[model samples]
Target: MPHRLHLEQFGPVHALPVLHYRLEFAHLVREAVRRVKPDCIAIELPSTIEAPFLRAVERLPEISVIHYEGRQRRDGAESVYLLVEPADPLVEGARLALERRIPLRLVDVDTDSYPRHVEALPDSYAIHRIGLTPYYEEYRRAAASVAPGREDRRRERGMAWRLQELAKEHGSILFVCGMYHLERIKDDFGRPQAAPLERVRRQGVRLFNLHPDSCREILDEFPFISAVHELRRGPLPPEPDDRGETLRKRFSAFELIVGGRKDLPAEELLRHAVERGARHAGRGEEFPDRQRIIFRLFQEAARHYRQETGDPVHLWQKRAFFRFARNYALASGALLPDLFQLLMAARGCVDDNFAYALWRLATFYHWQRAEADIPTISISPEEIWGGSRRIRFRPRERRRKGLSHLGFLKRKKEKRPGEWLEGFTDPSICSYPPEDVLIEEYGRFLKKKGAMQLSEELSRTEPFTSSLLDGIDLRETLRNVADGRVYVRESQRAKGGVGSVVVIFDEDRENGNYPYRTTWLGEHEQESDMAFYATPPEDNIVGPGICRCEYGGFLLSYPPRRMMDVWRDPDYVFARSKPEVLLLAALDYSPEKHVVHVAARPPRSIFRQIAARMGKKIVHIPLGSLSSVKLKSIRVLHILHGHDKRQVAKDYIW
Candidate 1:
């Protein structure tokens, strides 16, 4: 609703005072200006700074600041800077007036006399739900309850007097000021009492460029909100719609951050997430509310983090990470976390690289770099955006030659004869092999996941209660409690231990990245015999001869000596693929009836027939079904020099 000025002495001017924090205010002011089309526009800023302030507005999306020295009081010097952000409503409204060539008046007292006060106010966004009149009424009532400040009343009367003079010059006008001062300004309109505008000595006025990274610090809204405001090239509502714009922008950002790698799966995952969130929105409501949209984007980014680095971020972990982010926002006196806070929380809760994914998702705005020909000045983003930090960069000294060292200059060279060193590559000297620890841990994890599959295969029978079968079925018993009956369970004997295990990361011909392959003999006689294909540890020596290798295909069979080097065995020539040979070898070595085959897909019918011929059944466990992160960790194995090196290896294995 338009704010009508009903003063008998002052003509028909709309006094439109607006809250400055939200992007909605920019839109509100824009609409008000278009609708009223008043004969003249009156703004709250002083006439002296108006020219440069408007110039700063023209320089955006290349942000600039208006710096002017305030009245030099006897106590100290004071200076004021008006950050010309894209989302400021007063600036936006003024820009519209200038564009339309409306006669404009600067009505408020100059900056030198303006008094600043602190007040904790409710969220300005609530005005989107409630009309401006109601919001102002609530604000006015609250103000009346508290003792008014002398400085505030003086400022209101000054503005009111200025508005009256402006109304005398123009038939109708629009006055834009702070919401807190408008009610009192109206009460003092056309009154004989007038507050004298203070005049004092002023200093140099200048404009400074604002860095893109510093936009968040100086702007009223979060960096992400400013980013969105820029992307839309206009103000967005409190709860805006997500029409795949975020997905497209984030994907572009992800590609740029990752150096132009197109990730179709990640893109599809985010698209599906947005679609799912849209389904939960109310009818006729904007699909995928902004908050929900951001949540889903973060979730999809986490999933992509897993795909890229083999680190799974569980749903609970995501929840906890955002909880920390929100807390950071609250500590910073913001309603929600900005991109910087979210990235900081993600890095602490997740990993350093994982936060990179979130940052890419959050800071991307399509219109950030417009092709406008506007002149821009340069300033370091660090100088403005460095929060609570004082950073300085200086030229570093050049590196000196090694021989330039004073001690090295005085040293003399000594020669020694070349001789063979013992135990350099001997495997027997290693006390504990890292492969053994990795295999044992991985086998434990596989067994845990496989237990569920085993239970699914088992049959449950309901008969007269005998002992507890599979531990008393508490859920079943509780369901029948009202019927006056107690239910019990029977335990079944398991077939055998997880004796034979085959883990294949990728199908044959797909293991291009993992080129180096080898088989290692078990250092411990009690441990399971293993034969596998992996990246050679010798290629990546972490410590001396200790090398890290990723397993492309592996076979672990318990009861030492049951498994042989399937890679070297010539009798397995009938197998068409490398993984097939491992699978065939696992089946041939397994003394038990079933062999666990973990891969993306189940083995072909020929492998099943071959296993059946050998009186062994193959238990197919989809590798994708298990946690990729756990599997990736398990696949990483370190090769030690020898068994004698076990003590040293133990320290580095974990």
Candidate 2:
């Protein structure tokens, strides 16, 4: 009973106004057709290219383009293209008519010289919330101010004439046209209309299958959302009721169908995801909610990203992504973010690997293929949209030759399986020299930071009489502005410098994730003796002797060889978790008065008491305060089986 279903009815003709090539409008067209059940369907396409256009539509989920040479002008002859996509309302109407065996009409004037009109219209997504009738009314009010050109008027009259001619035979006709021309066409229909000048037929109009890659750049709706619409058009699997018996019955059938296929189609996977999302949201699956669809898309993309990079996308990153995307869409005057904004958000919130994963998933259309019965043509964003924006995605893993031009390079791989693992024969393992230097530098930086923090904690502020102890305390002076008295701060330096730094990347309370625990003595005075627990090195062999691992928690003590193997020593047996053990070792081994502790949360109160007993102050610095990018860069450590393996490690490492 929505106003959209009851369009502008004029006797036998019911005209439906739509924003061409929009997913919401396409849904509205399908709903309108089901409700109206008209005998004939009329669309605002030129009769000249009707054959090629219809043929393209018949291809359905596989997208196609109607290409033809336009009329020559003073500038030159230009090429015209009509994309036949499931998201297009006109194409949907024609498809419905053909499927129902109803008469189809392409009634626009056949002039190849129609000037392309670009209007700053509201996003079509608004229709989903406000209803199509209100959306169209607002658009019509704004468009009334801009008068149509002579050619537009001629086309309107020509379509009106064709509708009148068709009305003689068909009892009911459904007219689907762009909102811009609907009013003029209705006006011409009320009055007696004459056939305007137009070509009777177009020659050399051909249909071509759209190359799959081109769908990312040229499709009106991105492929992911388009595929959702296409999936909804077919018969959907039955949903479960409260009794649950029906679900069990249907699931068996579903499993049977899935068991037969070697590889499940992408659409089928998307369908399952959509249904699961809808069930979780307590919403009906009658229409696809764009917001939920995008959420599922991100989840799927994140899954792929984790599979490819072995790094999971955190919940905080997902929250940041949606927040950024929402703000970007608002800045662009859109209710929802487009493909570009989504990609930007993904890249900004996470990393290039995740962005690449999202782009790959968004551009995938199951039915599109390089080889087709019809001619396959590739197009670029520049050709279809006049201009384009660029985003660089430097994925960790290299791609094949076709994508090498897009900033992807071939990565080094072992010539044979288990070849890299053969280099692990040496008994002794040592840290890569460059990684040692990086960690040593970071330890020094942490020592300095801890000393500064300790100094701040011991600083005192008092009323200034004559001599300022250190400097005027601007904050304290401002607080006593009413008294007109100045305050000076006297900073006290710690008795001894920091000697040990403990950084906990993961608490590992269950002691499960990081299984490789070791204590290594430094080779010289420059490197700190270290104790750390990390992922098992044998799991990821980057080179023959070089294995990559991530740190869980680590303790660094200065004065090189003074520290013993803390992981094995029974002195720290009272510690509960891996991080606690490291903290205990740092407090015990630090010769200086202060020890630096970096982690997501402060160490337990018992650790502070233990540090106090050991005559050392624990300086707790939040892990989040530092740059995550820098932390990630330093987290990865490469272990070489022998010191000599460092010579060839660089070639295998990224």
Candidate 3:
């Protein structure tokens, strides 16, 4: 993170205008001059992009190019957009020189040498050779990456030489290049200049890095110019409410988080974050709507609190007694709090825990149904409604923000609700329970808020109790089972089959009794509660974690974990049980040898071997279990990749 006082947006210095999505390198070069005030600015752009740079420094102007060459394409259309042709970075740096009346310079390969750095020539490296000096090995590798055609690249390697040569020339010369290649680079010819930098010290050349802030600004100013910059767009997007500015400022935080993976540059991490946010949104149907609503509530509350207290402090009294606020003058990247942040931020609003609960529920939906294509919705000003003097609840029927599994599922449909709900009148009925209960009853809450759109088909039809219609309407019926009048029972005729919902009592018990309150087991459990409780035969057994079933697929624990073997073996099964998580402990042998037990069935052992060999490739078990027939015990998350000595040997290579 740059010092808060030292942030800037880029545009060409003295360029005719300022336009959104127009400026590029010129803006960056110009900003560097002001914020860094570095004696020298070294850039990392390719030598080929250097010529036009000279023109800008020389104060020469040219026409803009309308076409973009090779930006990424989606749906076969151009993804990179350029509002105005950018004055290359070289030209921008040079122009800055004239304005500041300082020396401007370019650092690149000396075209005369086929490859600028000796290190670049792997076979010809001095360090790897017999008794070659470390200096030669270092220089050899560094020079190899420079463009084989540029000559000035020598400036980096010949730093001592350049210093002595430029002793006659006074003042600092800044070198401008792209940020990506900066770290991988070394002084030209792989020279070790740090010692020389301390002992000899150069007069004309001074090196300073153009950081993430400036980098993001330059990239933010225009459309796609490189794959690297594009990656910074993450899970959440910039909002446009009062909270929007603060949210944007949060985006500036990089060093505090994943700074260890330098290989996964800041830009890449940002892009991943944005995608994750989008994925979270699109993962569920209720998320986009719920996130948007809460964000609106936050924005409204934040703005109002700021006005009352004359400070922009966070007030999360509930989750933690924590509150944070930037100087009112500072810029924020987001208009609303993130889902996590909002959990705490809600304390500033109502005393009730509903806001926090709603947010958590949405989080659970994402974690549980991670397999679903849910979309994440950024809580933007447009999505918010309550901020107005006359507050309203506008349930957007449209798809939500960052794409998630649910968002994907909803978007894939052609339905026309949740896009935007503008005109809703208060319904006279109050028989339906609260929004929380609805979501608890049904898989997800209807779109957003307690209000659910009763589809013409499902709502008016009379409830059916016939076994023939049960399978087709399982999930839907499970939803309606919340009504106390409905009771799901097993058919008396079949041993392993299910029946339908039948009224056990003539009168209603309580306002409503959700039948599906307990988690459903499986296909068998849906039809018959007995199927849910049927225990594995004592002689044979049931194991935990993933076990290649005697039959085809895999099995998992129906409810939460309540096992003894899971305690003994930690690796047998994954216990958290994420979406479609297979709890194998249920099938693993607890009392008998699985091999002997299944010896009655040969294919099962074969299947287990195949599954073990393949691991995740063969099957995915969110909850795992292992059964030891000889030990007569079942273990969940108890097994490692059952030994592949050859693969393990290869994997352990240091």
As for TM-score, the candidate ahead, 1 or 3, is: 1
Error of 1 at 543 (Å): 20
Taking the tens digit of each residue's C-alpha lDDT, what string does model 3 give over 1-654?
Answer: 111111211211111111122123344445546665645443332233344334322322211211122223564522221211233554455555666666544434322122222221222111112212233334446655656433343334433333323333534434453322222232222333431222222122211122222222223221122211222212344432222221111111122123211233323333333333333432332112223333333443344333322223233332232232111112233322333344433443332233333232222211111121222112222212113111222211234477552332332211232211111122211111122132222211111111121122123323556544322445555778777334333222211111111111101123222111122222233121101111111111111111111111122232223333332346544433211112233234212111111111122244455335433111211110111121111110111122222232222111
Which segments of candidate 2 are over 4 A away from where they belong? 1-6, 235-284, 394-422, 451-496, 507-512, 562-576, 601-615, 642-644
- Top lDDT model: 2
* Candidate 2 residue lDDT tens string, 1-654: 244453788869988898888888887888888778899999999888888888888898899988888888788877778899998999999999889899999998888767889888898878777787878888889999998998999899999999999999999899999999998888888889887877897788889999988987799898888877776676554552223111101112122223311334445553454444334322445577788778878987887665445455766788899999999999989989999999999999988878988887787776898899999999888777788888898755534466564332343555655556567789998888888888898989888988888889999999999889999999999999999999999999988889899998888777787989999999997888999999887655666778778898899998889888888889888878888888888888888888999998998899889888888889999886665556766787888899889888877666
Best by TM-score: 2
Better of 1 and 2 by TM-score: 2
Which candidate would rank higher by TM-score, 2 or 3? 2
In model 3, where do residues sit more than 4 Å from their true spots? 1-28, 35-53, 56-91, 110-168, 179-472, 477-654
Candidate 3 lDDT (Cα, 0 to 1): 0.27
Regarding lDDT, does 1 or 3 come out ahead? Answer: 1
Off by over 4 Å in 1: 1-11, 71-76, 111-116, 129-134, 169-172, 190-195, 216-218, 234-352, 359-654
Candidate 3 lDDT score at position 381:
22
Q: Candidate 1's error at 329, in angstroms? A: 6.9
Global lDDT scores for all candidate models: 0.60, 0.81, 0.27
TM-scores vs. true structure, each candidate: 0.55, 0.81, 0.23
